[model samples]
Target: MDTVMKERDLAGKQREAESINFADLSPTSGFFFTSPFRSLSTEGCLTNVSEPAVDGDVINGKFQQAMQAAFSDARAAGIKHPVLCGAIPFDKRQPSALFVPKKTHWIERSAVMAAVQAQESELPAVLSKTELPEQQQFMQMVTDAVKAMNDGKLEKAVLSRLLEIKTRGAVERPALLNRIIDQNPNGYHFHVPLEQGALIGASPELLLRKNGNQFYSNPLAGSARRESCPQQDAEVSRVLLDSGKDLYEHQIVTEGMRQVLADRSRHLHIPATPELLSTPTLWHLSTPIDGDVLDPQENALSLACLLHPTPALCGSPTRIARDLIEQLEPFDRGLFGGIVGWCDDRGNGEWVVTIRCGTVNGDHVRLFAGAGIVPDSSPESEWRETGVKLNTMLRAFGLN
Candidate 1:
C-alpha cells in the first residue's frame, strides 16, 4: 500500500469511496472537444489533486526510469494506494475542435431520441480537390519524413489531414447515436462529447488503468481494417502481418512500451510477438503490457505523463521525431492525439489515447486523421491511409 493512507485498513476504506462509478456524462446535444493528449490537468473533477505525487517525464530513457524510481520511492514513503494511467497531449499541429457555449435550445435526450429522426445529409465537397499539391510535391513530404528517419531523427511522424463535414436541417444527435449503436461491436462504444469543450477521436487505445497497487496499459500501434467477408478479412490480416512497413511500425511501439514498463516495474510480461486485430475499417498490431507499480505516492496521472507520446501515437527516439514534426508538418494537432481518462481520490483512473477522432465547433466541424510514417512508408499511400483514419470520426458525424 502507498503511504497516502495511514494504514492498510484505512487504504481499503479510501479505495472503496474512490471507486464509485458515474453515468457517462457525454452530452446529448451540446458541443464538446477532447484532446488526444492526456495530462494531470485532464484529471480534474475525477481525482483529488491534494495528494503528494511525482509526475514522470517520459521524454527520454532518463524520464522513463524516473517513473519506476518514483513508484518505489512512493512505496518506501508508506503511501497505501497508488494509481497509474497514461496521458498524451493533443497534437497541436493539426486542425482540432475547440469547445464553445451552446447557443441553441437545449433538447433533452427523450426529445431527440423519441420522434426526431436523423435526416440525410451530404458531406461538403472537397472544394478545389485539385487545389492540393501535386503527387510529386506530396511525395516530397514523404522523402523529407524518410530522410529524418534515416538521420535517426524519428521513428514515426503522424502526418494527417483535415476533412470537412456538413449536415442539413437540425443536426441529428440521435441519428449519430443510433448509427454508432448499430455499428458498435461488443457494446464497447462510449459517447464522450465535449461539453462546452471539444475532444478528438473514437480512440481504441487504452493507455493505462489503476486499481490498488496494480496498473495496466494497452498500447495499440499497428493497424488494418476488418472486412465483412471472413475470407477477405483473413487475407487482409495476413497482408498486414506480412507488411514490412507495418511490422516496423509495430516494433517501434512494442519496444517503446517494453522500455517504459521496465523503467516503472521489475517484472513485466510483453508478448515476444504481436497479435493482429481488425477494426471496422483498419487493422492494428497490438501488445498488452502489465506490471506491478513500483511507486505508490504518485497517481495514475503521473504514470500517464510518462507513458504518453509513445511510439504508437508519436514515435520512438521521441525528441528527435518531435523536432522533425515541428519542422515538417503544417498543422496543430490540439487534442486529436492526446489522452482522456478519469481518476479518483485513492488515485485510481483509466485513460485512453485519443485517435480516430475529430473536433466539432458549432455548424462547422474540423476532423483530423494521421498515419504513422516508417522507413518503407510511402507518402502518397500514407496520405490515403490518413483518409481511412479520418473516416472513423467522419462516420461518427453521419457524414459518410
Candidate 2:
C-alpha cells in the first residue's frame, strides 16, 4: 500500500490511469472511481471495506467502524483522508463498497491529457436486449400509480423501467464514459467498477457532498426535454415552471429534504423555489439544500444513507412509496436510484444519486429511468419522460 513510483514511473502510472480500458484493480476486489466535473479521478485500490451492519442504526455504526479502519490504513500510508467509493444500494444491507487508501495518487484532468487525446473506438455494430417491457405495460403501470395517488394511497411513487442493451463484443467502458463526459461536461460523471461489470453515467443530481461540517444536496424532480432551439428550450422551461403538477412534484422533494436534514444539521437552507437545471437531454426543476452537520463525524456517505431514496427517486411517504414501487416495478433497481460517489475518512466526500446510468456486464448493459407519478400524471407524458431520460445514457452508445 505504500509503494512509491519513481519520476518516470509516475508518468507511466498516470498514463495507465488515464487509459480508457486500464483498470488496475479487479472488479471483484478493487475499483476505479472518478468525478469528471471536479477534474479528479482515481484508479487502483488499497483496501475494500464491507458495511457490516444489517440495518437500522447499526448500519452507521458498521460504516463508522469501516471508516476508522480505512483511515488507520491511510494514516500509515501518509494520507489524511482516504477516498471510499461504491454504490449504496436502495437496500442498504447489500454488500457494496470499494475503499482506496490514501496511498494511491489522484490524477487530475491536466495530468490525463494523453488519455483524452486517445482515439475513440467504435462500439459493436449489433446490439440486443434480453427483454424490454412493452409500451402498453409501462403505460398501464403508470395509470395504476396515478390511480393510487388519487385514491390517497400515496402522494407520489416513482416508477422505473429498465432497458437492456447488448453488443456482440465487450463494451469499451472507458470509451463510453469519456463520451458521456465530453457531452456532459458539467454533469457528475462517474465510472464505478463492480463484480458483475461496471456502473457508468453522467448524473444530473447531487445527493450529498460533505466538506467538514458543511454539506450540500441538490435534488431534481420535475423535468422537461431540452429542445434544440434556444427559444423553444426557454419556452419549455417556462412551461415546466408554470405547470402546477411539476411544481407540486418539485415541492415534495424539497420539503422531504428539509424534513430529513433538519434534525441532523444545526442550520439548513433551502431555496423558496426551484431553479432550472439542464442536462444534455432534459431540463429539470432543481433545489439546492445546504446544511451544517451537527455531528462532525458524519461523512458524505452517512448523509446520503439518511436521504438515499429521496422523494425525487422514490415518492412521498417514503415507506408507502417504497412498498408501491415493489408492487409495481418488475425488475430489481439494484444500483439505480441508489447513491454513488466518494467519501473520505475526515468526514468529507461527495455522493450523487445513481441516475442517468447503466450497468455494463461484458457485452450487455442495462439502463434505467423513472418518472414521478402524481394524481394528475399523464401516462403518455410519463412514458415520454422515461424515454428522454434514457437518452442520456443512450447518447453515450452513439444512439439517439
Candidate 3:
C-alpha cells in the first residue's frame, strides 16, 4: 500500500456508529431531502413538472432554458423563493421530473419524526423476484465486458440490473422512508414522486453541493459488505484499501471528477487517497472533495448535470461506456443511476448520485445496483457487490 493509504488504513479502521430514536420521525409525501446542511420537505406542486423540449445535452439544450423559465414563472406567480426539485433520468435524453412546489418546510429530522401520524404499514411479503438479467446471465455479461475491456473497447463500464420484485401488497413509500432514515440516518435521504411511482433512497455519493461560491461532493467507489464480527470487518476494509484493482477503480472516478470540475472550480481539494466510509450495510472508499465555482451564477443543478455519468456511475471514457451499457443491459436505467435532490433559484442545493435506491409502484418495486467492471474485476465479486449494495433499501423493508 502507498504511504497515504497506510496512514488512512491505521486511522480509519474503526467504524462510526450513529443511533436514531424515532420519537419525531413521521411519514411525508411529495418531496423530501435530509443532508447535514439542511433537512426540508416540500409539497403540492405550484407548477407542472417541466421537461426538456429537445433532447441534447442533459444540462444545456432547451431543457435548462425551460427549467430556468419555470423558475421565472414561479417568481412571477408571487412565490418569493422557488425551488425546482425532482429526479433527473439516467439517460440524459430522458425527460426530467422537476417542478416548483407550493409549500416547503425546512425542518429537523427529529421534527419529521414528531410529525408522524400514520401508523407504520406492514411491508408486503415478497411474492417473487425476477431479475431483469438472471444471475448467471449477469455474470456472463460481466465476462463479456471484461473481454471487451481486454480487447480495448473501453477502460470500465458500470452495468446495472433491476430486481423486479412482486409483493403481497403495494409497497408504502412513507413507511419505507421512515425505515430508511431510521436505519441509515447519515446518508443523503430523498423522496420525489414520479408519474408512475416515487424515487426514494438514501445515497452516499454526493454528486455536488452549492452553498454560495463554495461547492462540495463526496464520491464513493470500491466497496465491500460489512461483516458481523468487528475484526472481520476491519480486515475487509484493510483489504479494500490495499487492493490495487479497487484503488485503480477509485482513481478513475476521483481523477475524472477532478478533470471535469477543474474548469468549473476556481480551487478544488482532493485527497491523494480515499478513506473508508461505512453505511449500515457496507464499507465504501470515499473521497470528500470541495472547491469554489468559477461562476457565481452556476446553479447546483447545472454543475451536477455537468458532472453526471462520472466513471463512478458510468465508466471511464464516458461515451463508450454509456454505449456499452446500452448494448449490454436488458433494461433502460431511467432514473436509477441518475441524480436526486433539489436546486433553488439562489443556486444553493444538494444532489446525490442515485444509488442504493428503488422505485415503488403498487405491488412492484424495482431496485437498482451496479458495480464498476474494470480489467481486473471478477464476475462473481461484482455480482456479490450489487447484492451487498442493495441491502440499504432492502433492509429498510425488513428483508434480508
The Cα local distance difference test for each model comes to 0.53, 0.74, 0.80
How well does model 2 score by local distance difference test? 0.74
- Candidate 1 stretches greater than 4 Å from native: 1-88, 91-139, 169-178, 186-197, 397-400
> Please, what are the lDDT tens digits per residue for candidate 1 over residues 1-400?
1211222333344333232211222333333222112112112121112212223333233433443444445455554433322223454323222111212111222222222233343333332222123445556776888887787656787555566554443334434534543343311222344443244344666777666667666677667766789999899889888888787888888788778778677457777776765567787787766667776654565566667777777776877767766566566565656665554435555667777654544444566666788888887787767767766666655444
User: Which candidate number would show the highest lDDT if scored against the true structure?
Assistant: 3
Candidate 1 has its poorest 10 consecutive residues by lDDT at 33-42
By TM-score, the candidates rank as 3, 2, 1
TM-score of each: 0.69, 0.86, 0.90
Ranking by lDDT: 3, 2, 1
Candidate 3, residue 7: lDDT: 26
Winning candidate number (TM-score): 3
Model 2 C-alpha RMSD to native: 6.8
Across residues 1-400, which tens digit of lDDT does each residue of candidate 3 receive? 3533532442233112322333433325688887666567776888865574234224455766787788899999887778888888877777777889887666555445444433454577889987778899899889988888987768889988888789988877877787787678678888888888888899988888787787888888888889999999999999989989989999999999998889877888999999998888888898988889887777788788888878999998899899888989998898899988888888888889999999898888999999999999899999999888888878877777
Model 2, C-alpha of 58: deviation from truth (Å):
7.0
After superposition on all C-alphas, the RMSD of every candidate to the true structure, in Å, is: 9.6, 6.8, 6.0
